[model samples]
Target chain A: MDIPSHITIKEVGPRDGLQNEKVILSTKEKIAWINRLSQTGLSYIEVTSFVPAKWIPALADALEVASTIERKKGVTYAALVPNIYGLERALQANIDEINVFVSSSETHNKRNVNKSISDTLDVIKEVADQSLFTGRKVRGYVSTIFGCPYEGKINLDKIKKIIDSLLNMGIYEISLGDTIGIANPLQVEHTLEELKKSFPLSIFAMHFHNTYGRGLANILVSLQQGITTYDSSFGGLGGCPYAAGASGNVATNDLVNMLHTMHVQTGIDERALTLARRIIDDKLGKRFSSHLLQIKNEQVKK
Target chain B: MDIPSHITIKEVGPRDGLQNEKVILSTKEKIAWINRLSQTGLSYIEVTSFVPAKWIPALADALEVASTIERKKGVTYAALVPNIYGLERALQANIDEINVFVSSSETHNKRNVNKSISDTLDVIKEVADQSLFTGRKVRGYVSTIFGCPYEGKINLDKIKKIIDSLLNMGIYEISLGDTIGIANPLQVEHTLEELKKSFPLSIFAMHFHNTYGRGLANILVSLQQGITTYDSSFGGLGGCPYAAGASGNVATNDLVNMLHTMHVQTGIDERALTLARRIIDDKLGKRFSSHLLQIKNEQVKK
Candidate 1:
């Protein structure tokens, strides 16, 4: 019942979404999709990740995408920067915001980035400091905060420590990731309650996956807990590469629709979001996982 | 969070689920699926609808299925009875409970049952009386409580009047249905708050569809308002017959999985529900709308 009147939706379809996909979009296609996303009234868009081509070939055109997207005024264009080299590339591309991520679980952290949690933090510290020095705001992503596929339930203490480190390194916000999409509403409430005791809730964002159809439910609890910022993908694109059964991030269209229906202002144009989804759908030639997309498809059939 | 520690799930997959499908299951297959559902610890199952064969050929074998399923001792096998004639057949099938449904919107009621709201309630009144006189408890379903495809936003006063009429007719519990899957959490919270002012929350259940993927989110708000009973279908099976682009009911597997994860007991086995879904999947040869099914498919591929 205690929901925010307005919320911020950070579109992550281009980076987090396309990274896990098999089909590689041309640099021009990626730029076109981001341009479409920019017109959707989303204030923030993560356009691409600067990870190496060997790590995520689908997003290997990260520099091209980051540099070529038509950056709309008042919109923050972000790119994921894994280390100093990635940060250099993102900086060269003039990304508006730099996002660095590390997994909360040791096993998942090692498997994802070939580094321990501590080592990942060390790299993130350098990236955050460098980005801050360059007058660019940096956001931190703490993955597997809810549950890790290999290690199962993550420790809250570990998540707290990682968040603390990120905040100490001049990171402006920390996005908590449910990498395996195993979080329930109660778990989200408890975690947020604990985190709120340590830091202001405004400094945190919820990044959920809709694997078991609990993404919106989790978001509902987060809203009740005063979380206003959420990270979602267009048409529910992307899945965890390391977690076998993990699904994509929660769909941006579904999130915006729910928010608007509930009278929670998201400032998003649902019609425009669909247009962005169409761009990706055309390039990938695959069906998406979003319920809104299914409804649209049904309407088209009729 | 004020969430209930224990909840009741009324399984509607066999009746509401199959009735909307293009592929009609044989009576034997329906009975087998119901028997499998009985093993999953569901205390209530709406097995079939006793409508005229001309109206719903998919459920033409209703009496055969209702009578032949291997009913577990603690489970209440129920059936949908539209009129006195349907009630007679349901009584003959020895169903434990009778469910009567009417749409809150006038146009949907006319389109679905070819009768005015008043006339449909008149029929429901007679059906309820006969079923109660026969010593069978009757439940009521009020569809399109959230929004109607034909009428758009439904009037709460109209819904309240319909619910009052049904309760006056000896209907024990009323299941509030989002027939078009248009309800959001705030709407759910507001509606339940208003309804609780007139009736005890104990006498109401929430029935939601996943058309826009807001089902679980809506359920979260309902739970916060002390709604402990829900109607769900295995594998998200059914869609509204008259509502264009409506998706299936909120999946029982996803519902039970979330409840169990949140430590809210429904006494339902997730694995057993999956087994029951397999039966329907084999019979229909189609993928379901439930996220749990998608996750299972992903796991199987791995």
Candidate 2:
């Protein structure tokens, strides 16, 4: 297969990974991990979320994480904003970028953020408008774009509509999250094929969870679709707050491993990513979801 | 995507998954597991291998396991053969079908079976002739159809040629094996697009390992291509002799869970597979690799 020559992975572990983790990371460790990822030449690093402490208290230190991280010159550090209030908080933190999620599956949308699809979109639109007024770039996320645990297979027509609305609202790049992690490569193939009909590949990114263990496969499928931007968690840490039993997002190390093997250049260093995963897994006192982190072999380069 | 109405899984745990495991099972447990799989309604089961004990001493109990298992009416039992001599042993064991493997990569063939590509072809031809003389159906296996751990990426043209040879040798069907579990769904898509030009969907099946955690994803891609029959290990058992630190084949339990979720009909029973995996994992003193077995929520439908 003629895969792409290079890909961009926006590491989101500091925010997405920690938000759902059971053992709350000391704000210091979270900052340390994000700082570690910064030195690896990553262009974008999601720092934290601005949700209230009552919701996802694991990231209650969001403001602390955002302000304490060591941001490199070219890196764009972003954070998840739940609404206009969260967006205002993000603006106060002076973050590089902002992200808002509206799940494609209505059931997940309600359960995830306690808002109906339309209601969620309204909040997102208002927040996007406000962000635009402030000259801050806002990225839109459409989670469970392909399949959902509660709803089964998703309607991609609905997915496209959400993408269209988000794009029309002047949001930045949209990431299609396989939230429940049930989608396979075929789903990815068809989803990208349909999305390509309306939007440019540069406007789209992929977020996959490793629930059924298809994260890397889905990422590879996305790569074949000419998608350069990806969402990965360091040490493969991160699971959806709503989807139980789902593993972490695609491990940063694993994604890099597969990319380097396919002769694709991912500007990030594989060794540094591995070390980041090691720190997280050791701190958590549990194994990280990444298989690459578990096996430290020099043979990874070949 | 219009997923297939049904998918056929050719359970290969007894032969493929168990063979490479360091722990050896006695004839009684082997017979028990093989017989248990029969009740699960798997149509095709690779129950044993006929290689020399010196080569695969773990399966030296092949004869006893093959002889003692109570046969089910609709299930077709099979064995893997290395050469004509292995085929003779399978014939003596009354194996309903025999499978032989050849590599698309010349280097893999040489390293795997210690024979050149042409020499391996000659050997397969001899075995096929013997199977024809004995009125037994010979199923061929094209191993490393994806990238090989030893040789890296394989040429689709060479693979089509090897498959053509197997077809011309009077083999009934050829199962394409991803020996290294590095293939993504697109690689599967890319290869199937080429192989289908020469081989019909009915004449081809897939043998996948879950090493890089894409077994189910790759299966979804294959199912979309109309390939029904698949090879899986119980509890995701099995490891490649070539890929160091790679995990087991896609767990039979995990495969069934996914297929059942997709509203596809497979005769296999998920609960029984889970029970069998528990037995295997308990005996081995470690967590088994199957994703379904790891799920604690246990929505295991009968």
Candidate 3:
């Protein structure tokens, strides 16, 4: 199996992770965490989401958080935008990239955004076009690409159509998410084998959840398929609010540790990433899930 | 990657898991756990270790645990035997198999058993000869085959020598262990690729720790290399007492989940395995570190 010499890791801790948590970090705390993440040699950081405050109080301070953090020289600071209103807010905050999300499963799409798949696609098409006109890169996220909590196995043809539509609308990158963390290696191989046939590897990334401990194994399969970009949360901070038993995104430290150990260079400062995880974990008054952080905690006890 | 159609899972929770815990279960508790494990369709279960009570107070009732459990028709009840004395005790308990372990790294060997590698080899040879005559299957475990806690990376030559010694002793299976949980897929591939040239696939198994969260990934690499049998603990119990933050063996549920999801038949009932995990977790008054168990807990909360 061929493995890449280098891979790209996008940190989504501030957005995806904190949104699912009960405790809310203050605007200052959010900026501090994002600022810390910027120094970790990561190319992209999904700083926050621009959804309505009433809908998600956890990320209500997204505007202030987006404007305050001192942007790093080489890092791209991005934000999740739900619709034209959220995209407008993100544009006001000067987000480097606008990320639009939709789920392949109809049940998940209706529950997550209260819209049908076609409506969500229309929004994505409109947002991507607007973002491109505003001189910003647009990233598309297809959630529940592997399996859905309500609908079970997602149709591969549906996912392919979504990807084709997103790519045609000037979306620069597309991240396929296993929202409920039900992906297996063979399932990943099957999905990618078919997906790669219609698209090049350059526009694709993987965002896996570690709810069932299949995150790294799925990543291994994807790496062999030559997809290099991965989206992760520091400290493994997010869980699906809709899916019971679904845990956080794969931890950035754990992902980097495996990548570096396998000689797949990620250019991340391991120490800096841990410090970033610690800052948010301490504020949340809990130790978030992370294999590297857990080991570090043990070392401290020793 | 060539994935196996079937894999062997040897449950080591009853022995290796409880041995490293702070709380010792009562003899009755141990018996109950083992009995529950037997109904889980597992073909092999390491019920207890035959070391003296002073060495492992947690499993002091190994003899009682061994004598009481109702063995399933096809299950092989095994125990960890330290030497001739431990093997003799195991023989008295009518263990279906006897397992002997030694570390590949000299520093780990000296710390773990207070014996030199050559001294340990002599004991294994003598014990294997005795066990063969008694008509019990002999399994050899080579710990720290990938990396060591004391010595960073173990020498491949040293591991080859250990395998040769174990094979010469008439041991039927040699389980390569990642004692410190520091194994990466590339490291596993590197070691297994070299080891496979000399040994047939039938004689090798993998014992990985989830300490750094690379357990499943390492297992994936090994499966691709055509190694089938795996050693795992229920609820991912059994941490490295010497190595800080070293979690227990990979959880049997997580292993089965990945294997079954990949269409690799392991003949294990998923619900039965979780029931086994619950019995131990409730008795210990703490949840162990299996990703699958943790998710199940979340589901129960909901």
Candidate 4:
């Protein structure tokens, strides 16, 4: 099957990958990494999240990083915003796009931002309103779409309602997130089949973790159902702080490699991404959760 | 999907899993594990291969193990027979089923079994005929179905020819083996689509490895396509000897867990399989390659 000509790689390395790192980078370091990723040809890079510094100390410098990071031509630097406060702060930072996240699992949403599913959606409405007023792009994320750690099977009706509400409020795109990576291909297909029947393929993207080792496979199923955009972290960075026993996001380089071999152009160079991974690994002083990073690192050593 | 009533968990742990272990198990230990696995409710157990003793000393006791091991009720104990000679030896041990494997990659075929693809098929024809004459079932394995470590991408036509040849020679089931474990859902779908054109879904089985972490995803894709029979090793114990970079097979307990959650029946007990893994790990002095195994091991310690 001929997949779409272009697939968008929304880089979550700066925000998602960095937030999970024990050694939090300075705002300047995060900005530099974002700029470097821009040069490496990523169209979208999520700079940081505007959550409480007390909750996510790594992104304590989110505002500074968002404001200061140089926006390259054609690069869409996005940031995660929890509510109207985070949204207003993001708007002030002049990001190209803004991301608002809620959980598909009720338990996850309750644990994540200390709000119920309804409460979180109520707040995100304000963010949507703010986006509409300012003419800024608002993207919605439904995390824990597959299996939730606390509640094993997530209600797909809830996922659909959240997506419908987000789409109804005029969100540009919605990402279906498998928060803990417990998703297999069938789950991905089963969820996507139901979602595709309702949502247009253009408005739906996928976010997957490799915790249970089905990240790329899940991506493939989504792609088959005509999904062309995805959110991934470089070196498999980023995890859910609220979800128990979650690992990093699906690796950007690994997805790039698979898509490239399938002749699906992802725009970002695999070699360049691998090089960036090497630089990141050296800076981090340990291995990332990515196989592509390790493979690239060994090739560099040789 | 009303998948096969019993998702036959072919415990390849004995042959497929142990062949890659750093330390070779004595005949007694390997036999003991196989025996214990038999008691744990696996329907199909690939005990060992009847290949050369010098080549695979890890399973040099293939004949003895097959002949002597306590054959449990409902367990179809099989052996890997490379050629007519190996099949003769398997016959000597009175294996219930005989499995013959061929790679879709010509390059891998030459390097792996020291024969060209066509030559390998010619040899298996003799084995298939002998097995058929004796009323012993013959299972065909067209391995590297997803991608090959040595040769890289494998073509669907190559896979088709191998499977068609095996079917023509009276093989009962054809297993599509992802030897390298690099298959994504899209590729698996594409391959299955092509295979289904020639063969009915009922006689097809899936064998997956988790090397690049796509094992379960591929299986899910297969399951959606109405595939019922799956071959998984206990504790995810198998690695490829010919395909060096491939990871262990999809864990039996993990497979059963995912299937059970999806409301599919495998007729296998995940808890008993978990316990069997403990027995294997205690004897082997190493952790098994399973998410449940690692998690349960820690839980037991606590």
Arrange candidates by lDDT, highest first: which order?
Answer: 1, 3, 2, 4
Q: What DockQ does every candidate get?
A: 0.68, 0.28, 0.70, 0.24
The lowest-lDDT stretch of 10 consecutive residues in candidate 3 chain A is: A278-287
How many Å off is the CA of B90 in candidate 3? 0.9
Task: Give the per-residue lDDT digits (tens) of candidate 1, residues B1-302.
Answer: 78899999999988888888887888888888899999999999999999999999999999888888887899999999989899889989999999999999999999889999999999998998888898999999999999998899988888999999999999999999998888999999999999988999999999998888989999988988989999999888887665455568998989999999999999988888887766766665354777777667666667
Higher-DockQ candidate of 3 and 4: 3
- Two-chain complex of model 2, DockQ on C-alpha atoms against the true structure: 0.28
TM-score of chain A of 4: 0.94
Candidate 4: tens digits of C-alpha lDDT, residues A1-302: 54676799999888878887776766666777777788778999888999988888889888899999888999888899998888878888987788999987888789898899999999999888888788888999888888787887888787889989998888989988877777776677787878778877789888887765567767877877789999998877765454433447898877887787567888887767766654455566343656555444544566
In TM-score terms, candidate 3 sits at 0.98
TM-score, second chain, candidate 1: 0.96
**Residue lDDT tens for model 4, B190-272:** 87788778778788888887765557767877876778788887777765554443348887877787777667776776667
Taking the tens digit of each residue's C-alpha lDDT, what string does model 2 give over B194-229?
887877878998888877666776887788778888
TM-scores of the models, in the order given: 0.97, 0.84, 0.98, 0.85
Select the stronger candidate by lDDT from 1 and 3.
Answer: 1
- Give lDDT: candidate 2, residue B244: 56
Worst 10 residues of 1 chain A by lDDT: A278-287
Candidate 1's DockQ is 0.68
Ranked by TM-score, the better of candidates 1 and 2 is: 1
lDDT of 3 by residue, A56-108 (tens): 99999999999989999999999999999999899989999999999999999
lDDT of each: 0.88, 0.79, 0.87, 0.78
